[model samples]
Target: MTAPLHWKLVIDTTDAQTLADFWAAALGYEVEDQSRLIAQLLSSGDLPEAAVTEHDGRRAFRGLAAVRHPEDPYDAFTGIGAGRRLLFQDVPEPKTVKNRLHIDVHAEPDGRDDLVARLETLGATRLREVNQGPAGHWWVMLDPEGNEFCVA
Candidate 1:
């Protein structure tokens, strides 16, 4: 039998921490706390001061942040998720093309509208509403940095 590979979705953004926070709140996930790891690396002179930033009053990597499913296991020392996770990394260039991949958020049918509204309040923008006559109905939304995702 073949073994399944573990993976996390990585997204490029202009502001990693901001996007990570938005995704964490939108998906009911938790932002990975790497303060301890950052401190350890800094103390060891392995990570430079320029590579660090502060988020929510805690040390974080300057151009990186991540969110993970609350129930997932993770490395205690490094604060890296071992299961479902999303990593956001900063890139110099702006997104110029439509995404080849996107995330679809499934909500209770009765609560989808509320969920969309809540996402909007979290800095997501409603791009459009998509209805497929019976297959499904969903809202196409853009995250704070304009990455596309769906609320279904």
Candidate 2:
């Protein structure tokens, strides 16, 4: 039998850094810090100045940014996380339809509204509330790029 596998949720976005920032805040995750590696690349002439970008007022990797659980083990040199992560990669076009796979944000009932409000402030738009009788209800929302998610 095969063992369990580990994976990350990869998202395509036009502005990777921005999306990373939002999701990081929403999930209380840490942005993977790769400045050290980038600096080495720059000094070794393996990377150009144009390969870096300013994000959240700090130097960050260009074209892609990722956020990981704060407590996750990671490779300090490469900034690769070993736990839950969301990697935002650059794409040419925007999202045009509902996501076939969507994440459901689950929080304590007392904190659900606050969490939803916080997500809204971070660029998520509330689509509508869904109540499934006994199974419970959730709020359908769209991310900054229009991908669907639920806050419950």
Candidate 3:
């Protein structure tokens, strides 16, 4: 039999912390708080001082940041989520092509518009309206880095 597997959705970004912050607010998730480990590593030279940076006045890994479902169980040592998570890792290339896979955020029937508006205020851009006839409708939007997602 196959062993159990778990995963997180990871995206390449120019600024990991900012993207993590945007998604944390947009999804109502919390930024993974890994400062304690970072401080320990920095002090012991396990991690170089340059390997960490500050975001929102808190220390964070320089190239990566993540958000986790608020209610998800997480490792206190690494501050990593055991359930749903989204990780942003820094990359040099810009996003030039459309996404072949994307995230769709579902909400209460009456909450779509308000949620879309809220995301826009967080730096998401409206792409277009997708109407699927009898299936339903959803708003396609781009994140601050131009990554596409849907509010349905």
Candidate models: Cα lDDT each: 0.96, 0.88, 0.94
**Clashing residue pairs, backbone N/CA/C < 3 A, model 2:** none
Write model 2 residue lDDT over 1-152, tens digit each, in one string.
99879999999889999888888888899889888888888899999999899876767778899999999899989898999999999888878877888888898767888999989999999999999988987899988988898998
Q: Which 10-residue window in model 2 sums to the lowest lDDT?
A: 54-63
Tens digits of lDDT, candidate 3, 1-152:
99788999999999999999999998899999999999999888899988999998889999899999999999998898999999999998999999988999997878999999999999999999999988989999999999999989
Higher-TM-score candidate among 2 and 3?
Answer: 3
Among these predictions, the greatest TM-score belongs to 1
How many Å off is the CA of 8 in candidate 1? 0.6
Candidate 2, residue 43: lDDT: 90
**Model 1 CA deviation exceeding 4 Å by range:** none
Candidate 2's clash total is: 0
Encode model 1's per-residue lDDT on 1-152: one tens digit a residue: 98999999999999999999999999999999999999999999999999999999999999999999999999999999999999999999999998999999999868999999999999999999999978989999999998899999
User: Which residue pairs collide, candidate 3?
Assistant: none
lDDT for model 3, please.
0.94
Candidate 3's C-alpha runs over 4 A off are 1-3
